[model samples]
Target: MDETRQWTAEAARAAAGKKGEETVVLDVGDLFGITDAFVITSASNVRLVRTIVEEVDRRVKAVGGPAPYRVEGTDDARWVLMDYGDFVVHVFLEEARRYYDLERLWADAPRLEWDEHDGRAVATRP
Candidate 1:
């Protein structure tokens, strides 16, 4: 498994366990310079968003991953972003997710696949 994909998968699965919806892992390594991958997830409300973020953090840490370099939007409750250097995590509310439309903006970037049955994340294509 690619190390970065493993991080994103762990984050995605953690968020999903917390009831996060629309979870996606995008391979943005070739698209930009700031990060290699992105793990995006959405929740229904602010509280759920917070919960998802916390759960993701905990799960990632449980896997012996490095802590995020920076975390933002916990109080704002709009869109929380956790920067872990190699992979960035975004937990957003439904409206904010649609407004930002990251999936559309980064449409050119290939998506990483996550197998829920096995809990693995892999980059399958460009």
Candidate 2:
């Protein structure tokens, strides 16, 4: 996998390590020029949301991925956005995730499948 994809998978795994649910990676490079992909996941509560965000940052950095250029929504912890230039990590509370439905918003973008057991991108789902 490319560096961006590797970093995205690491972010997803980090979120999942914090028990983040419904983790998915969207290849939005074709549709969104600002970034190549999005790593999205949901947590059960505000605390979990924060935890997932922290874990994602730590793990990604540990793997030599660059720190997020900017992070937003930490104050609310409902939907934190971690912008890393090439990709962004979205950690949200269950309600916030369901409300925003980013998956539906970018439905046309192909889903990059990650191995649930290891958090490695295995294939792309059209």
Candidate 3:
């Protein structure tokens, strides 16, 4: 299995645990040398959004992935950002995600196709 794929899968699983919606993995390898992917998802409520953030943090640590460089938005939890060096995961309440619209902002980045066989995601240009 590929490292990128594994990373993406871990992200998806974490998002699912918190009932994340419209989860997307963006390949930003070409744009940012610091990270390979961006796993984005939104929850319906602030609590669920925070839960999604913690779940992603926990799962990534369980896999021995590097800890996030920083985390923000705990108090309100409308939008939580986890900044891991290779992959940044964003957990947000639905309305907040819509307001930020990261996917649309980074529309040029390639969307990853999940390989359900092994719970991995293969990068591909849109």
Candidate 4:
């Protein structure tokens, strides 16, 4: 796998650990082309959402993931988007996840699964 994908996955893991959720990493490289991946996960509440956003931001920066081009819906705390140039992260409350249906929006893109135990597993389409 490429280095950017590796960093993004690491960032996702950090966010999940901070927020305590089941996170899914999606490979959007085929669809968007610009972004290499999307890290999709749910937060139980506004506090969890904020935790995820902060965690992702801090870890990504620490690991040298490119700064997000933009972030949206942060103040509302329902849904927070951290748009790293090569990988966009969507941290959503359960309702927001269901309402936005981002999984369905990028349904065509392949799912990138990870090994929760090892923290090194990665998945992508050829």
Candidate 2 per-residue C-alpha lDDT over 58-93 given as tens digits, one digit per residue, 9 for 90 to 100: 999998999999999999999999999999999989
lDDT-wise, the better of 3 and 4 is 3
Model 4 bad stretches (over 4 Å): 116-121, 124-126
lDDT values, one for every candidate: 0.89, 0.90, 0.81, 0.78
Better of 2 and 3 by lDDT: 2
| C-alpha RMSD by candidate, in order | 1.5, 1.4, 1.9, 2.3
Model 3 deviation from the true structure expressed as Cα RMSD, one decimal place = 1.9
Q: List the residue pairs that clash in candidate 2.
A: none
Give the per-residue Cα lDDT of candidate 3 at 61.
76
Of 1 and 3, the candidate ahead on TM-score is 1
Number of the top-ranking candidate, with lDDT as the measure: 2
lDDT of each residue in 32-65, candidate 1, tens digit only: 8889988999999999999999998998888878
TM-score of each: 0.94, 0.94, 0.88, 0.86
> Candidate 4 vs. truth: CA RMSD?
2.3
Positional deviation of residue 43's Cα in model 2 after best superposition, in angstroms: 0.6
How does model 3 score by TM-score? 0.88
lDDT of 3 by residue, 3-61 (tens): 65577778877787679998888988788788888888999988788788888888877
